[model samples]
Target: MKQHLFHGYMTKNVQKRISEATTAILPSEREMNSGINKARRAMTPTIPTTQLFDIAEPFTKTLHDDDFLIVDKMITRRQRILLFASREQLKMLLGVDTILMDGTFSTCPSVFDQVYTIHAVKYDQSFPCVFGLLPNRLKTTYHFMFQELKSVAMQMQ
Candidate 1:
């Protein structure tokens, strides 16, 4: 019989400890989210900020594109961790059901309509994982992404 590293499901104390650790490691809610209500404050994606605005038409104007799609692996295993942080941050900023449909500005919330859209960066799985408090996936993924990015940089040079 081996001792388990974690429980089958988190206990209340475990959840509390983890939450406190996360708060310390990340930031206080006020510190983590200190810009949403401000006028025209923006975030660089890496830093958590507040700017809950429309999701659809703005994408076209900002990206200068008319067509787009978002796809991803189902939330499970490591994805659960990733989606938790990403979606939590997004919710802190943009609320839960804010992203647009068809990239043409239609509102939908049909379970599959606009749900679980979380990513450390753009929902590019190949872009590298960003699962915090994970099984150290971020470190390895960052290492691989670094190599890939370096290769592209060399090609440009």
Candidate 2:
């Protein structure tokens, strides 16, 4: 198909050589993926870690309402964002004693590390109460998550 696209541009000899080379050694899937990854890495722009907070600041500010709800958020130096629950969600979380925490990597974006979630359980059902994008599964990150939660909970009161 590509050869056809460049049909008139290439000489007959050049076309024959390219065709023979392609047929003689077809690239494996791994080789194709390696080239694709290389191209993507080259094209992808690198954002400074500190600048990440600046980029998200506007979006986080918009999450708030007139009731002062949706105002709780934690952002680390590495740009890990732990978006806490709203006033109503926080109330529900307080009602439950056994909260669950889980990290989902498959849904995580390449920009961050993982999607760490907090769940509140009631009546044998688990409800996701909070969401965070962490740079890694570091102890400090997890500590920040809880510290932010406590700070936010106090604010809700």
* RMSD for each of the candidates: 19.5, 12.0
Estimated TM-score for each candidate: 0.17, 0.55
Q: Tell me the lDDT of model 2 at 109.
A: 72
Q: What is the C-alpha lDDT of each candidate?
A: 0.31, 0.67
Give the Å error, residue 9, model 1.
49
Top-TM-score structure, candidate number: 2
lDDT of 2: 0.67
**lDDT (tens digit, per residue) of candidate 2 on 125-151:** 998877777777788878877787788
Residues 73-152 of candidate 1 have per-residue lDDT tens digits of 22333331111122233333232233221111133222222222223233322221222211123445434433543443
lDDT of 2 at 154: 81
> Candidate 2, 69: how far from true, in Å?
9.0
